[model samples]
Target: MMALAVDLALALVAAAAALSFWRLLIGPSAPDRILALDTLYINTIALLILLGLRLDSALYFEAALLIAVIGFVGTLALCKYLLRGDIIE
Candidate 1:
């Protein structure tokens, strides 16, 4: 059933988010932590989209889109910092 599929998807995404959080907390390197943060935000967007599907509403989709954009920009900034030692010159 669709409901069962949605539940499964939600569980998988939640598990991924949890693992990413663990990495973020205890990663051995800065790049690892940054990668974990990026994964976490991506997982969050996935959750939001799954929720929208489950609830049969388009409302959560907008929030998911916003999160995606913000996450992308944040990742870029972090990468820039890692490369240049500063986010802005």
Candidate 2:
């Protein structure tokens, strides 16, 4: 059924998010942490989309869009800092 599929998707995405969080916390290097953060954001996006599908709400989609924008900016800043030792050049 559609409901069962949605539930399964949610569970899988949630598990992926948890693993990404673990990597973010325990990463041994800055680049590793950054990569983990990126993965976490991606997983967050997936979770948001799944929630939207389950709830049948447009609000969740908007929130997911906003998070995607912020996550992208944050990742760019982190990468810039890593490359240049400063985000503001």
Assess each prediction's global lDDT (C-alpha) against the native.
0.95, 0.91
Off by over 4 Å in 1: none
Best by lDDT: 1
List candidate 2 stretches off by more than 4 Å.
none
Looking at model 2, the pairs that clash are: none
Worst-scoring 10-residue span by lDDT in model 1: 61-70
lDDT of 2 by residue, 19-78 (tens): 998998999899899999989988988989888889888788888888899989999999
lDDT comparing candidate 2 with the true structure: 0.91
Candidate with top TM-score is: 2
**Per-residue CA lDDT of candidate 1, range 24-44, in tens?**
999999999999999999999
Q: Give candidate 1's TM-score.
A: 0.93
